[model samples]
Structure formats: C-alpha cells, structure tokens
Target: MSTENYPVVFGTEDILRSLCDSVSRVLSVTTQSQIRYSGMVQRISKTCLKPDIGCFVLFDGGFSGLVVINFSAPAAMELYEQYMLNMGMSKDELTTSHTSDEVSNVMGELMNQSVGDFTAKVARELQTHITQNQPKMMALSKQVILSVDTHLEKPEARRVTFFTGRNNIFYLELAIDRTEFIKLNDFDASEVPDPDALMDQVHGATAARPAPAVSGTSEHDELLNSLGM
Candidate 1:
C-alpha cells in the first residue's frame, strides 16, 4: 500500500495536546507529583491571564503562538511547595503565600521548562524550530485579557484544564495560527532523551578509559642511560 494514501493530518488540537503533554511531563518529573490534563478541551476566541497567578510565554519561528497558564492560589502554592520540597527544602523554609516573588519565579521557571520541552518536541516531531521568549508571570487580583503582539493569520485558541497532585486546578490557554501539517511519508518521531541515562553513559565511558602511563624513577634512569648521560 502506498503510504501517501493514508496521510496523517496534524492540526490545532494536535499541537495543543503536545504542549499539554510537555506541561504534564515536566511538572510531574520536577515536583515528583502526578500532573494531568482534561481530555476535553475548550475552543476559545482569545487567551487571557486570570487570577491568582498568571503566566504567559510567546514563541516564534516555525510558528508563532502564545501560552498562558493561570494558576489559582491553592494550585500555585501546591506546586511551589512540592517543587521546593522535592529539592530537599523543609516545609518551614517555604513561603506560605503565592503572592511572594519566589513563588512567581518558581512558577515562571516551570512554565519555561514546559514550553521548552514543547518546542524541542516540535523540532523533533514536526521537523521545524520555534523560539520562546522568557515567561512573564504575575500575581493578578483580577482577570486581564491579553493577546499576542505578533500578528497571527487565522488565529485559533484553546483552553485545557490541568490538575496538580493535590487536585488543585489550573488552566492552560494556547493561541496559535490555524495551521495543519500533512504527513507525506511515514517516519518515526524521535523519543525524548533521558538526562540520567546520558550521564550514566558518560560516567561509564570515563571509568572504562585507561589511565595515562606515568613516568617513574626507573623510566627516567632508562631514558638517561639511553641518552648516554
């Protein structure tokens, strides 16, 4: 059978799914907690930053888009606490309020990692590159509607619900140009590389390498004698 006959189409929802996977994967690993998203997605006209913690990142290159994650106060604190605890920090040393700059910084960092993973997958799976700007995070008291500064032709927006290990709810919003990628031929998408496995391989190779020969007094004497000194 000709492969072209069964062309696979990748569209807006597909891209949103990839971004959601990256979010879940990165957060799950970082905080050692179960992070998941709802299977059903909401089609929205625009993306916004909602209280209590709002974060957004813009990306361009292969495709331009904006990613917004609105975390409730409880959701923000839960993730921040879990991430810090995972890093060996005691609960007493943690901040209790999500309004703290530290909490915003941590959330922003996680958002950055999530988008980074998404972009990497896009490069590997879609065979195209995208560049993301630094994530901007704010502790909002009210909802603020924001749009991407860059013009997106035929823009499409989506919102997905996410839950942390503690069942704290948050929302993820994505706005991108309406685009589709039709597969022309069959190819396997590359898997994400494991950092721990890569480090183990490096250490194993280093251990297997033979040490360089060291010069001793006997060898020095042998050299001197060979020189007729």
Candidate 2:
C-alpha cells in the first residue's frame, strides 16, 4: 500500500500562536515593525466587534480554517502611513488622512502576506501541505456577525491580539471546525527541531559575521530598532 503524510493536529492555542508568529514575521519583513502577542480568546467576544477594518483569508487541505484580521482605527492609520512610506510615498503626498479605500487596500495587502506566511508556518509545523485563498478585504462601519455553519459543529474560533512596537494593538480571529482540526492532527515530533540546536545554529552564524564599526554600529541598530526593525 502507498503511504502518505498526514496533517498535524494542533490545539486552538497552537493555532493562535502560529498565526501570531506569522503576523510578527510579516510586520518585520514588510513594515520593519515588531509585535508581541497580547491575549487570546476562544470565542467571538465583544472585543472582536466594531473593528475599523477586516481581512479574511480562507485555508484548505486537511487543515481547513478562516483567518480574519481586524484593525482598530489608530492601528490602521499607523500601518497605512508606514506602508505608504515604505512604498516610497513622501510625507507631502500624505497630507490628507487615509480614506477607507486606501486603508482597505493596504490592510488587504498586509494580511495577504501575513496569511501567506501563516500557511507556510503551518505547513512546516504540520509537515503537510496547506492551501490558502486570496485575501478579501472588508470595510465596515462596525464589526461583522458571521453565521455559523450548523452542518459543522460551531467553529472552534479564537481571537488573538498583538501589540506592535509602537504600542498599537490589532487582533485576528481564527475559526476552524472542531472535527476538522482534530482530524488534521498527526503530529510528528521529528519535524520540529530542538530549541537548543536551533539556538546553537543561530549563535554559530552570528559568530561568523564580521564585527561592525564600533562607533556607528550602535547608532545604526538604534535607528533600526526605533523603526521597529
């Protein structure tokens, strides 16, 4: 008989942290921003309501789910400004505040990268393939109320919040059918590298890098850190 790899089973918490890690990676590479997880909730609570903007990305494969990101007004504005600047727009070009269309577009692109990263991370974690749908952005006057698919037990959903280096807070919600998530579990311990081994690899690589000029290295690092790099 032919054999096939199975998807890894992950708890709601594992999924939330992986998504958060994906967000952090996207922010770091795209916006040069840093983020840390703030909190998580297992259901659609009031806190997940009334977001200024939202982006939804669907996933397929053995691990089917939805990732919905909601940005607060301040968080949206901050990200928009930085994203525009990174796109080479001048401050003068940004004299006016961002409109709904602009915010939606920028956030759509951001979430697209984030969810793409999430899928990659999930694939590595699960040691199985996963597919993602194109991200869809929604501009809303208030939060959306998603209808539950009765055919599938109430989706195992969670709200995960993260704080940016600039102290801005934004959150994303993850929803996967409970049965699907459980079915996907086929965890392989060997797929995950040892933490100590990874740390040694990092240290070894860092040790091989040439020393920076003492006078300017700190200043340069400070500048990048200020930009949340």
Candidate 3:
C-alpha cells in the first residue's frame, strides 16, 4: 500500500484548483489572483512567502497517519475577504490586517470541503472510504514560528506546491497522506468539537477575533462587534 503513495496528493497546485472550484461552486467569485503554491511538501526548509494563519490535521480513524494543512498570511487574507468579507478586498486592507479566529471561521467550512474533496478523490482510486476529522483551528504570529514545516507520524506522506494568480503565483495549498484518509462522515455533528468553545479559544488567544465582516469597512467594522462571532 505504501508503494502506491502519490506525492501529488500534497500538490498545492491541484489542491488550490480544488479549493477554487469548491468555494466557487458554493460561493461566487471572479478569481482574479494569480496564486502560486510551493511544490515541496510544507516544511521548515521552505520559506513562507507570507504570514502564517493556523495548522490543521486529518485522521482516517483506524490506522492512517495524521497530516497537517497550512496557509500564508496573504492566502489567509484572500480567504477571509473572498470567502467571508465579500470577494472584493483591496490589497492594502489584506496586507495590513491581523488574523483572527473569525478569519478561520470564514474559511473553516470551505477548508473542510477542500480537504474532504481531496480525500474522496484519493480514496476512490484506492477503493477505500475516506472521511475528514473535525478541523483544529488556532491563531499564531509569524514571529514565534521557528518553522513553517509540518510532519505526520505515519510512514507515508505526500507534498507539492503551485503558484496561482493573474501573475502566476500560488497562494494556497494542502498536504495529505493518501493512506491517511479517515471516515469523517462516520460521526454526527454533535460528536465534533464545539465550534463555540473553539472560537472562544481563538478569541482568548488572538487580538480579539475580528467581528464578522460588516457591510462596509467603516460602517461594517463598527457593526462587527454586534454581529457576535
């Protein structure tokens, strides 16, 4: 089974395409950015082109190893604005912005979808039922991060990267162990981690989770507090 492992599973290019497709289907977007993801597996050796948001791990339930997911600050901003803040974000707003769990929340369901789709695709080839575990979200600064790298105890792993955008730069990525696909659908929603508790943790750690995106930056930013993330 190990020999069948495909490094392309970690291919950011493919995952980015998958994510773009997944998000676009559920949410509308012009997809103007030229996103590019590094080809190498997400590792400390690879330099982050942007800020770090958080890391997520996947489990197959029985024997598969856990795998990690990561994104750069720019990518996170794109996700926050495109998915949550409405697909029209000015470059300045995205660059200067600080990340929060709210940002994570905007992209969480989409992230789950992307990974789940990737898992299903990989599993179909192997004739196995793959599922997603409840995603673990966290907030962190780029300063303390010694390494942008990630690894799993499983014997098998796959990594890849790509650049996407009008200029042909990769913005986002996903890494997976094909053998590690878990049966995430196996459990009911209640069995999953409480999003409320998780969000509380994020607010407690980050610089006050940004209130939900307001109608306009000014009018909305003020109203964000009342939205109750």
Look at candidate 1 and give me any clashing residue pairs: none
TM-score on alpha carbons, each prediction: 0.79, 0.66, 0.47
> Which has the better TM-score: candidate 1, or candidate 3?
1
lDDT of 1 by residue, 49-122 (tens): 88999999999998889999999999999999999999999999999989999999999999999999999999
Best by lDDT: 1
Inter-residue clash pairs, candidate 2: 8-185, 9-185, 9-186
Any idea what lDDT model 3 has? Answer: 0.47
Worst 10 residues of 3 by lDDT: 181-190
Over 4 Å off, model 3: 1-51, 61-63, 85-96, 146-154, 157-159, 162-229
TM-score of 2: 0.66
Candidate with best TM-score: 1
Write down the lDDT of every candidate, Cα atoms only: 0.91, 0.70, 0.47
Model 1 misplaced stretches (Cα beyond 4 Å) = 1-6, 143-150, 191-229
- TM-score of candidate 1 against the unseen true structure: 0.79
By lDDT, the better pick of 1 and 2 is 1
Runs with alpha carbons beyond 4 Å of true place in candidate 2: 1-9, 39-42, 45-49, 142-151, 179-229
Q: How many backbone clashes does candidate 2 have?
A: 3
lDDT (tens digit, per residue) of candidate 2 on 1-229: 3223545357667777878888877876676667677754657632233446667777877667777777777777778777788889886776344346777788788888888877777766656577987877765565364432323345677787777768988777777766424343445634756799999999999999999766746777999989999
